[model samples]
Target: MKKVIIPLALCLITAACGGDENDGKTEPEMKISSCYVVSSSSGQSENFSSPVGMYITSEAGQPYEGSGVWSASYNSGAWAMDKPVYVTKAGKVYAYYPYSSNDSPPVLPLDMTRQTDVLYSRVASPIAPGSVSLSVKLYHALSKLVVSVKGEEVTGLSLSSPVKCRFNICTGEFTDLQSGQVTSTDGRLFVVPHVTVGKEMIITLKSGKQYTYSVDGTEFRAGESYTYEFQLNEDRDKLEILDISVEDWINDNNYNDYLRR
Candidate 1:
């Protein structure tokens, strides 16, 4: 249960509406009594447990005025489907990610190798009876550093610099952020918070071995993903960078099956 304090203006706009004349028409649609909040994400399956918070403001008055905050939890398993979210006013709807109380942009963690789920979307309101769908696009705020060791048992791993990722909560977009050296015990993969293309990565193995990999020339786009395979060169005492590959974030091994559907 995340907590948030919305300004009264947004609250009023979403919760109710004031009586106003319409070109000589008598009654405005008595405030929007109910609505449905549908959620969708590009290249991803449905998240039935994720909730979305929103506010609907009337198009008649100042845009987004007097709207109150409301929450809608998604319960559907079908991708790109609409869920029910009740609203008092029938206007434009503003929706944000995580649906939790925290409206701030998401902070990418140091160890993203295990987790890489972050997405957000917004829908202009006036939510209809059943088809008020809010399409959310999940963006990868972090870049993947895959280090596949073929010869030696890796005892430890750490980056030469820490990667810091910054993104816009409103737009679900990642910015060009920098990273510093951060240590990690996760050897196979490093889910870095920031884009670390063309940077220096220092890897340390359990056998008291260290290798510095110059990130490939490929740039790490926000929504895209990349991989670096490293191996132990038998001819030499040090490690070697095998190869670097890039692909759409949705196509990573974690999403191979779902994206195909």
Candidate 2:
């Protein structure tokens, strides 16, 4: 299980909310796989879904510097009706903020999703960001998920984890806050959290984008420290399940794939 403590400074002062894009119009994507969420004070974690597009945001809202050497590319497989696209200033896009368009503002593939059937119980972020400096740690987990990011603007093109949970709500859901239902009429598809009358589970992420991703699971367990980052497609969902060590997650080819959709 991963453990974290909301900073005393953040909790005492009027700290702005991170991860969950409560005020923005977009959020990368959040998932709940099979990792455990245990508080440092309690040592408890939860198991949830994992996706590919939310990894960039894991670098935000930390106490140290963050940086990374990874990026999400566009690819196509069984789920895509047409070939997936790699978005750039010169590529065809509609807006560059939400959808991928071959025309219009020519929005790039800024918003993408990848799903998997295998279970990921651990994760590490290479991009960790702070207020002034970013010291990205290689994918590793000695105590918690490590990340490094050092930029004014962070974009969450895609993020994938072995498990997903509200960073603060590692072992449970963030209830009490009223949740507003937002729908994408554009027909883009992604996973969503389950909603209740007074209990709406939401995960705010970096990249200045926040979206809904919910999971219904029971518990989680933790393995030894591990790390890995290889390939990810911004246009598709992803799942990776296997053992890893620092620097091993990226180059190791012995990973087991238990999902094919």
Top lDDT: which candidate number? 1
Worst 10 residues of 2 by lDDT: 88-97
lDDT of 1: 0.47
- Write model 2 residue lDDT over 162-212, tens digit each, in one string: 223221111222223322332222211122223223231232224344332
Q: What local lDDT does model 1 show for residue 30?
A: 19
Model 1 per-residue lDDT tens digits across residues 1-261: 999989999878865554333334332221222222222133454343345445445566333433244555433433321323343345555554334453432332222332434443432435543444444433444445556577655655556434455545444555554545555664643443443456666677766767776654445544445566777677656667777776655433444332222
Q: lDDT per model, in order?
A: 0.47, 0.23
Off by over 4 Å in 1: 1-43, 46-85, 88-100, 104-117, 122-137, 152-157, 160-166, 173-179, 187-198, 206-208, 216-218, 251-261
When superposed on Cα atoms, how far off is each prediction in RMSD?
Answer: 13.4, 25.9
Which ten residues in a row are the worst by lDDT in model 1? 30-39
